[model samples]
Target: MAPKDVMTNCHAKSILNAMNALRKSSTLCDVTLRVEQKDFAAHRIVLAACSDYFCAMFTSELSEKDKPYVDIQGLTASTMEILLDFVYTETVHVTVENVQELLPAACLLQLKGVKQACCEFLESQLDPSNCLGIRDFAETHNCVDLMQAAEVFSQKHFPEVVQHEEFILLNREEVEKLIKCDEIQVDSEEPVFEAVINWVKHSKKEREDSLPELLQYVRMPLLTPRYITDVIDTE
Candidate 1:
């Protein structure tokens, strides 16, 4: 074999295998991660090498450096378990169901790889029914790209999305923001007017006061004289 081809086999594969072996041996682990009431045994060197959060905790003269058990708050035991698995194996399987829960944990841990994976999974699951909610969630988590994608989806499918239960459940501020957007998909403003009417009717007593503000978004001149007279005559 040529010199370059002789060592074509990956050396990193062997290192990963060794790390996996160490991960399985609880007896060799020097540190324990305590999440909620559960504890996970882990090696300090592997964790420090893989995670910047752990690296800083271990390298600095911080309390975590001397402690055998480090208590991790705000993350559930199951989420931490999957994150640690990724740290050891360099692989993660993100699904739509778990992505919502895992993304926040990954963010807190400063695991960029897992966070990005979760964002991509969420982007794949976006649809007319859930786009607005996903946009809000992504913005809250500081996922800029995912938030923008969800917003565009919401704008393009506003007509269909407005009929979903999720749209009815939106808070007053959120509903107002969406109606104010010029990009909302409504043909000739009739659907926009009808959607606002339906929205107010959904919670008549409380939403009645919002009719004037919501109606301003609809182009009154585009509606036929008889259609407007028939709908607004009794109001």
Candidate 2:
């Protein structure tokens, strides 16, 4: 070897350990976070280093910079605890029970890593029964990769997905969007036609206006002549 090289501080574990100890002991903590009736002591430097929201609050000439105790609105105490733990530990347990709530809280705090973890967790949990809901949730939260993944999975499993109770819960526009997808798989057009009819019948007052538009998505030529005649008579 041209020179002897040495590696130190594997994974920065020592630094993280010290920071975690500070977090636990509340030593040198300069700020108090009040979230949904609970308080958490935290260091400004650590929070600023981890979150843009906290960074702006601490670094700016804003009134919050001088405040010893700040109230964080719209997040529950438990969610705040998890957020603080991630800030100190650089890790979090994203579960089905928590991802839905955690994603929004992470987004509010501008914690990109936790938000991304929630999105990844949601992506891994997609299934025929939940893909649509997950897709909607991802879209609502502006998670592009998770939204696309859920949308594609839902489209590919549209036949099976539509049979789920969640399908009937989809509003008129959502139903239209799914029906218009060319990638939706079905052995025959009958299922698609029957799904549309069932959706319309489920809430005629709300869905009747879209019946004519919904019917256009069905492949009439592929349906049996008898069924086609029966549809025409009903129309």
Candidate 3:
């Protein structure tokens, strides 16, 4: 083999050795640290070196079986740089994927910087358009704080978004669908749901009260003789 090929093989072997060392390392907090299969080929070395830090933040194993299948092949250096910066700066844009995983990791290792980043990201992303997905992600990751923030954002923005004719006309089933989609709890005793229900009720009541006034304006006046004579006498 050429010298370049020999060097490449040596580098690959070294990375594999580092990964094995990480896999066999003692659990930091009763959680096994294994390279995610999706991240193994390219990021195994980097991830393995960071295992102890990750273990400190995460209670669950880091094995491939735990997370959804994702393709990280196209991850750019810039992305990694941003992630690292977020970890340090504790500020990040929340629209990035796999944030659920990243946030936990940040919390576990006492990466207050990263945790702050996750919070900021979630705050910015919490809105009527994407609140449901954010709520799901938070619940799945057991992120209570994120969930609460999302609830607040949804409740604040819901009135403006749900006042449309389509939303006003939604049946119970349709409303439930929106609730589920937005990750808003329909059965929970939380104030968020309570506030939403109150808002809807108030809007409906206003519409109902306006109907009588609207009818009075549209109705034709009666042409009774008594009313005509009264009007003539007044004239």
lDDT of 2 at 80: 93
Worst 10-residue lDDT window, candidate 1: 225-234
Candidates 2 and 3 compared by lDDT, better number: 2
Clashing pairs in 2: none
Report clash pairs, candidate 3.
56-108, 57-108, 57-109, 90-113, 90-117, 91-117, 132-182
* TM-score of predicted structure 3: 0.34
Cα lDDT, model 2, residue 172: 83
Q: What does candidate 3's lDDT look like per residue over 58-89, in tens digits?
A: 33464542343323333343344445444323
Candidate 3 regions exceeding 4 Å error are 1-112, 161-235
Ranked candidates (TM-score, high to low): 2, 1, 3
Worst 10 residues of 2 by lDDT: 226-235
TM-score, model 1 to reference: 0.87
Report the Cα lDDT for candidate 2.
0.87
Ranking by lDDT: 2, 1, 3
Clashes of 3: 7
Query: Model 2 over residues 75-191: C-alpha lDDT tens digits?
Result: 899999999999988899998888888999999999999999999998889888899889888988899999999988987887888888789998988889898888887888878
